[model samples]
Target: MNYKRLLLCLLTGYTFAASPASAFQALQPLHEYDKVSKELVETLEGIHYNRPNIDDAISSKAFDYYIDALDPSKSFFLQSDIDSLTQYQNSFDDALRNGDVQVAYTIYNVYLERLEKRLLDLQEHLPEMVKGFDYTLDETLNTDPDKQTWATTDAELDDYWRKRLKNRALTLKINGESEEKILTMLERRYKNQLRQVDQTNATDVYQTFANAITSALDPHTSYFAPRASETFNINMSLSLEGIGAVLQMDDDYTKVVRLIPGGPAATQSDLSPNDRIIAVGQEGAPMVDVVGMRLDDVVDMIRGESDTTVVLEITSSKGDTQTSKRISIVRKKVKLEDQSAKKEVVDIERDGKTYKVGVITLPTFYSDFAAIQAGDKDYKSSTRDTKTLIDELRKENITALILDLRNNGGGSLQEANALTGLFIPAGPTVQIRDQSGRVTPLGDTDATITYSGPMAVLINRMSASASEIVAGAMQDYGRALILGDQSFGKGTVQVLQDLDKGQLKITQAKFYRVSGESTQHKGVMPDIAFPSLIDKETIGESALDNPLIWDKIHETRYPVYWNIPAYLPVLEPRHAARMAKDPNFVAINAQISDFKQQVETYKTVSLNEKTRIEQQETNKANELLRENTRRKALGLDTLTSVDDIEPIDEDTFAKEASEILLDFIATNQLAQQQAEKKTAQN
Candidate 1:
C-alpha cells in the first residue's frame, strides 16, 4: 500500500465493540504480551474516535512510523532496505496481536547492520575529510530529508554522510573555532554515536514499533518502555526529585531540552537549552562521563536526595568552540510551591490615576490526587492556591485582574473545573465527548464567585488543555477578556493503562467549550491578542499531521458575569492603537517575521562560505535591528552587536499586558458610571 491510500483509510471509520487497550525489542520486557495487544486494540477501536481498524491501512501506517522512528533523517535504511520491508507493512497488526514482533526485530537488525556500515565509513573517511575549508566548493544538503526520496544506491548514501559530516565541521569552523578543535570534536561525536548505536537494545526497537502503532491511532496516544514509563510518572507528578531539567537523547549526548520553571536549573538561571550534559558527579566523587550513556542511566546519575549537590560537565551550544564547563546544582524536589499559583499587583498609572491589576499566574492546572486520597486538607493544587491568591488580591483592593496562564500545559481536569469556577459563577465549564457519541458537560457545582470584577486571562501559545478550559469558560460567560496568542489547542484527554508491564497512554475523550467550540486544533482566540513570536501554524496542535479537527457542538447554558464581550468592540481599537506605536510590540512583530523568513531560508542553505557568512551576517543584523529599535524606544543605549544584546533583560510583554488591563478598567468603569447616572436621571 502507498502512503496516500493508507492515510485515506486512517480517516475512514471502522467500528469495533470491545474497547480495550506490544513489544518487539530489548528496551521493553514482553510482560503479559497476550493481554497488552488485546487491550490496546479494544481501547483504540472501542473508545477512540473514528474507530480506526488494524487492517492493511493501519499496518502500513505502523510501517511508516516504525521506519521513521529508526531513520528520522532518512539517512539510514537505503531504498533497498525500505523496499524489502514493503512485504511486512501489511502484517504488523497480526504480528503485534500474537505477541510476536520477531519480524519487526529482524528489520531492526537490518538497520543495525546499516548503522555499522555507516560508522565504519565515517571512521575510514573522517580523518581525510577534515583537510581544509574551501569557500568555493559547492554542495547542498537537504537537512529535512523527511520529504526527500531515500538513496537508491550505496553511492548516494555515501554522499549523504560525507556532506553531513562536512556541514557539521563547516558550521563549527564558521562559528570561529579552530580547525584542529573542530576535527577533534567531530571525531568524539562520531565515536559516541558508534557507542550509543551499539547500546541500542531490543526493548527500544519494540517501543518504537508500539508507539508507531498507537500514534497512528492518535498524536497523544503513546507506548512507553518500562524505564520511559517511570520517567513519565515522575514528570506527571510535579514532585520532580531528579535534576530540575528534562533530559532527552540528542544523538549520543544527554541534552537539556527545557527548564522546569522554578526548578533548580531555572531558579538559578545557570543553564540554557542546547547545553549538552557530558558527565555527572557528586560533591565528593569523581565525575562519570555520561556521553554515549543511556538517557535513563544519565538521569539516574544526576538524581540524588534534596540538598545534595551534583556537578554537571556541559558542552554549551553557544560561543565559538564547544565550550565545556562544570556547573553544580543542589538536588531538590520541584515543590508544588513552584507550580502553585501566585499573586502579584502591577500598578499601572494612566492620566495621573493608578489602576492596581491583580495578577495570578497559574503554572499548571494541578491536583495532588495522592494527598487528596490520603485525606490531607492542606494538599496543594492549582485551583485551591489560585483561590487563596484571589482572596488575598481582593483584600489588597485591586481594581482589575489578570489570570496569567502562560505555559500552563494543563493537568487535572478536576482542577480545570475548579479554576474555571473561580471566574464563572454557574453552569458547565466544558463538555467532553467520549467515543460512544455521548456528550457530558463538566460543570462547577460550587457557585462561589472568587472575584466579580473586571477580568482578563493572559495566555500564549504554550497555554493549553486545562488552561484553555478556564480561558474558554471566562470568554463564553463574557466574564473576562482573553489576551495573548492563541493557546496550544490540545483538546483531547488521555488515560494511562498498564500493558505488558509497561504503559499505554491513549486518547479517550476531547474537550469542548461552553460556547460549543472545540479547543482541539483551533484553540481559544484571544479577545485582544498580543504580538507573539510563536509560529502558530508550525508549533501548536494544528501543526501535527493527524490532529483532531476543530469543530463546534451544542452550546451549553452558562451565566454571563459582567458582559465583558459587549465592551471589547470599544476597547480593541484602543488596544490596537497602543500596540501600533509601542516599541516592544513592534520589536516582537519584527522578530516573528524574521523568524519565519529564517525558517524558509534555512531550508535551502548552500555549502559554501560566502553563502554561510552572508546568512549569518543577515541574521545578526536583523536581530540587532530589533534590539536597537526597542532599546531606542525605551531610551536605553543601542547595542553594537549580537553578543551585546544577549544579556539585555527587557521582556516587557507582561508589563504591556497589564497596561491593556488598566485601559479596560478605566474604560469599563467610566461606561458603568455613565449608565448609572442615566438610569438615576430616568
Candidate 2:
C-alpha cells in the first residue's frame, strides 16, 4: 500500500472468533485472550520495522509503561505496591509469547483498588475539606510528578491528597468560584472517577497493556481495541460531529494534541495545541470538570449533534499562571472545501517601492482519491489548486511568492511530491526505506515546471509528515527559502493492520530527504528561524517517548537550483534588524524568554490562596502591558486590559516573509550584474 494510507486507513479481511463475553466484563482476561495475545506478539515481532526481540529489556520497558500509563501522576500506587509488582517486570515478554496476560490484569486490578480507595476518601471528606481549607497556609503542590517521590505510608499519601485538594480549592477560590460551587464540582468529579474505576473491564486492561507493549517499540506504534478503533475511524473520516480537535490524555488532564484543518476548533474557537482542557459544558448547562475522567467519556460529552454548541475551559500552554478561560464552538462536520489551498496578494513596501507578493496558504496536502479513481479530469488536489492560484497571482504581476504551510498537518504523500515539482524541474523528492532495507525513490516523473520564481516556504511546529517532505525537498533543491520554526518532525510511515481482536498500527517505513537526512526526529530546519508560540518541550516528535533516532542514507543525485547560503548573509541581517524593532516580534521573544525563566524558577503550584492570587494578578498585568506596548507602537489606541486586545492578523509571518523575499530578489540581481560585468571584462 502507498504511504498516503499512513495510519489512518485499515487493512481488513482478517478475522477471528471472539468469546461471547459482555462488552464490559469484570477485570479479567477472556477465554480467547491468550490466542489473541500470541497473535499480537507474533505480528509485532515478525512485521514491525524494528523486528524487536521480546526479551528482558523490552519486558522491563513495557512494564514501566504499563504502570506509568495507569498512574502517570504517581498519585495512587506507592513504592510498596511497585515492589510487589517488581517480580513481573521481566516476565511480560514470556507471558506475551506464551499467550498469557495475567500479570497485566493483576497490575490493573491493584490500580483499580487504589483508585477506588483514593476516590472514596475524597468523596467522604472533599466537601468538608473545601470549606475548611485555610487559604493563608504556606504550602505548595508539586504538579510535576517527576520531581516528587511516591508516598511510602498511608498517612503520607493522605497528606499528599490534602495538599492536592487544597491547591484545587485555592485555585478555584482565586478564580472567583464560590465555596458552595467548588464543593459541588469537586464532589461530582471525585464521584465520577470512583464510578469509572468500578466500571473497569477486561477490555480496558487489555487495551492499555497492548498499547504499552506497542508504544515501547516506537511512539507511532499503537494497539487499538474495537471501540477505540471505531473512534479512530471516525476521526479519519474527518466528519465527526464535534469541535474537530484531537484530544489525548495527559496525566489527569485532557490535552489538545492538534487542530484539524477546516474543523470548528481550528476555524472558530481559540483552542490551541498543547492547551489542557480543564472542563467541558453543553449549551446552558453547568461546566463539568473533566479532570481524572476517562478520555472516552470526555469525548462522548464533547461530541454531539451538528449545529449544537460545546464549551471548553482551557488553560493555554503559553500561560504563566495556568489560568483557564472558556470558549464556545458550534459543532459541525469538517468540510474538505474549507481546507483547500487559497491565495492572496500583498504589497510589501521595501526601499520606498511596493512589491506585489503572492501568498498561497495550503492547510493540507489533500487529494480527492475518489474523484481520481473515478477518472475525473477536474480532480482537486493541493498541487492542482496551488497551480491555479499561482496562475491567478501571476496575472496580478506578483514579484515573489510565499507558500504558507504553517500549522499544515500533512495528508497525501503524492501531493507533496507533485507540489514540490511545481517549483523545480522533476526529480527525486523523497526516499522511502522499508522494513526489509529496500529504499524506493519517489518523485514527479513529468518534466514540467509550474511556478519558477523567487519563493519562500513558511512552516511551524505543526507542519508535519508530507509537509516535511515538501519542505525538505525545497531546502535540498535550494529552489525556495524555508522560514519559520522547525517542523513537526514526523518522517515515518505507519499502517494499520487488523488483528484477531484489536488493530495494530505498525511503523513500516522511514522517510528520508533527497539529501539523505532522515526527517524522523530532526525535521526540516528553516533558513531563518522565527520565534514560535508553540512550546517545543510539550510538542514535536522529540518530545515523545521512544522516538526513533535521526540517521542518514545515501543522497540521491539532483540539480541544485541556487546557492541559498550566499543570499542568507545579506537577508539574515536585514531581517533581524527589522524584527528587533517590530513590536509583535519583541513581545513574542519576551514571552518566550519569560516562559523559559518561569520553567527554570518554579515547578510547583502554591497551595496558599494569597500567593496564587498575587501571581495571577501579576501575570494579568504583565500581559496587559505587553499588549499595550504593541498597540502603542502601531499608533493604535492602547488597550486598558488584555481582554480589550482584538485578534491580530494571522498573516503577520507571511508579510514579514515577503519582505525577506524582496531582500533576496535585490541580492540576486546585484550578483547577476557583477558576474556579467566580470565576464565582459575578461
Candidate 3:
C-alpha cells in the first residue's frame, strides 16, 4: 500500500468541531468542547499503539507536560500559581472522561494572565532597564531551564526578568545594534508577545493541553487543530514556498526537526537539525524576537516568496552551552530532482592499484506517487533511481559500492523495502508490530540481486525511519557493512486520523529489524564507528520525551551472505590507525572534541561585556587554529580566521570507507586462496 498517499488523503480534509473558547477577560471552555474532548480520548485509547491506560499516573505526567508546554523556562507562572492548581494533577483523566475541559481552560487562562502581565511590565520598564544597564559587572546567566528553579515569589520573577532583559539588550548591542535600536526592538517584542497572548483562543489552549497528554504516550502522537491540520497537509504536500524545513515547538523555542534535502537551508545554509530558531528577520527588517511565539506564526515569519532572503538567528545547544549564529538564506522550492539519489565514483589508490568504489548519496527515500498514478512509465523512487545508478557504476567498472544514507531522514517505506531488495535476493526487510500485538514481516519479494558485490551502507544519527530499516536489513543479512554513527532511533509509524475536532497523528506501529531487534530507542550500531559531529543528546529519537523502548521479537529467517564481524578485528585497527593520521579525519575528531569541551566549560554564559568579548575572541582563535591545522596537514593554504574559511565538501568518511572496503576484499581473497592451498595440501 502507498502510505504517503494514504497519509496525504487523511490529512487534507478536516472539519471544525465548534467555535473556540474566548480568551483575555474570563477564559472558559465552549459547551461543545466536551463532546470533542470525549472523541479524542476514545480515539487515542482505542487505536494508539501503546494503548496506554490514561489513569491518575498518566494524568499526573500529562499535568507536568502541560505545565512545561505553557511555561517551559519556569519564567511565567510562580510557585503559588502551581500550588493553587496542584489539585488537578491527577484529575485530568477524569476531566477527559467526563468530557469536561474546564481545568485545561482554567490552567491556560492562568498562564495567559501571567504572560500578559509580564509582557505589559516589560513593555513599561524595558526602556528604563536598557538605560540603566551596566555591562561592566561580572555576572552569569544560567540559560538552561533544567538547572533553574521556579520563582518562589513575584519579586524573584521580577529579578530574573531584569537579568533576562539585560542579557537581551547586551546580545543586541554585541550584534552592533545601537542602544536606540535595542530599546526599540525589545519594546516591539514585548508588545508582540502581549498581542499574541490576547489573541490566544480556547482552541489553542485545547490543542496544547491535548498534545501534552498525547505526548505523554509518545513524542510522535499529537493533535493538530483545524488550521494546524491544514498547515500540516500543505507541508506534507511539499507545496510551501519557502525554506524547506520541518519545525516543531520545543518548549518556548522553534526547533528544527530536519531540513528538506536540496532546500536552501540544507544546501546553501548551515542550519543543522536540533538548532533553535531564536529570531527571524526578512530582507531589510529588524530581527523579530520569536522566543515565545507560536509555531505557526514563526513558520509564517520565516516563509516568503522565492528568491527573497530570510535571516534566521539559530541557537544550537550542547549540554548547557549554546552557540548562536545568524544565517541568511534565499528561499526556494525543494524540488524532487534535488532530493533524488545521485552517484559518484571515488577512486582509492592503494598498493599501486586504483580501486573505483561507487558511492550513491541518497538524500531521501522519495517517490512520485502522482506520476505513478498517472501511468507514467518512469517515476522517481529511491530504489528505481539507485538501481539505475548501480548499472551506470557497473559500466564504469566500479569494484565496490557505498550506499550513503547520512542525514537521509527517510521518506517512503515502500522505497526502503524495494531498495533493500536490490542487495539481497529475496527476504523480509523489516517487521511491523501493531497495537494488537500482531507482528507482520514486510520485505522484498523480488528475487533479482542487483549489486551483490562488496558493499557498505553509510548511516548517521539523522538517518531515521526508512533509513534505519534499510541499514538494519543490510546488517542483518551480512550483505553490506554498516558504517558511521548509529542510525536515528525512530522506528514507530504515525498515521493522521480525523477527530471530531482537528486531527490526531497517532503512533500506529513500531519497526523491527530482520533480526527481531526493535529500532526504537537504541538505533542500529555501525560495524565500524566513526567520529560523528551530530550531538546525540539533542537530535536522536532517544533524546525525545517518552520514546518507546527498544525490545526484540522472533528473528526472521534470512541467509547471511558473509561474516562481516569475523573480519572486524583486522579491519577496525587498520581503520582507526588511518583515521588518527588522516588530516581531514583528525580535524573532524578535533572539532567534535573541542565542541564537547566548550559544552563542559560554558554551562553558564558570562553577562559581563569584557568577559564575554574575551570568550568570543578565544573561541574564534581556537576554531581558526583547528582549521589551519587541517589545512596545513592537507598541504593546502591555511586560513587566517575561521570566518575566512569557505564551505568545502571534504568527505573523509567515504574516502576512509573505500579503504576499508578494499581491505575487506583483499582479506577475503587471501582467505579463499589460503583455503584452496590448504585443500591441496590435505
TM-score on alpha carbons, each prediction: 0.83, 0.94, 0.94
Which regions of candidate 2 fall more than 4 Å away from where they truly are?
1-26, 228-239
User: How would you encode candidate 2's per-residue C-alpha lDDT over 268-379 as one tens digit per residue?
Assistant: 8778888888789999999898998877788888899999999998877766635677889999988778889999988887678789999999999999889999999999
Q: Worst ten-residue run, lDDT, model 2?
A: 7-16
Q: Of models 1 and 2, which has the larger lDDT? A: 2
What lDDT does the true structure give each of the candidates?
0.72, 0.82, 0.83
* All candidates: CA RMSD (Å): 9.0, 9.3, 9.1
Q: Tally clashes: model 2.
A: 0
Error of 2 at 625 (Å): 0.7
Q: Kindly list the per-residue Cα lDDT of model 1 for residues 1-682, writing each as its tens digit.
A: 1323422343211111121110112333354454666666766777666667777788888888788767766777889989998889988888777667777777787777676666655665565566633546666667544456788976556556666666766766775767877677777665766666666666666677777787677778877877645422223321367657866655446776456656887664456655778778899975666655666667877888888888887865442112256778887788767878877888778789877778887777778888999999999888788889888998888888888887777778898898888776667999999877789999888777888887788888878888899899888888888888899899998888776557777788889999889999889899887876555765568866577788889998777766776777877798788878988777777776776666555555567777777767776787888889898998988878776664333236556677777777777789889999999999
- Look at candidate 2 and give me any clashing residue pairs: none
The local distance difference test score of model 1 is 0.72
Candidate 3 minimal-lDDT segment of 10 residues:
10-19
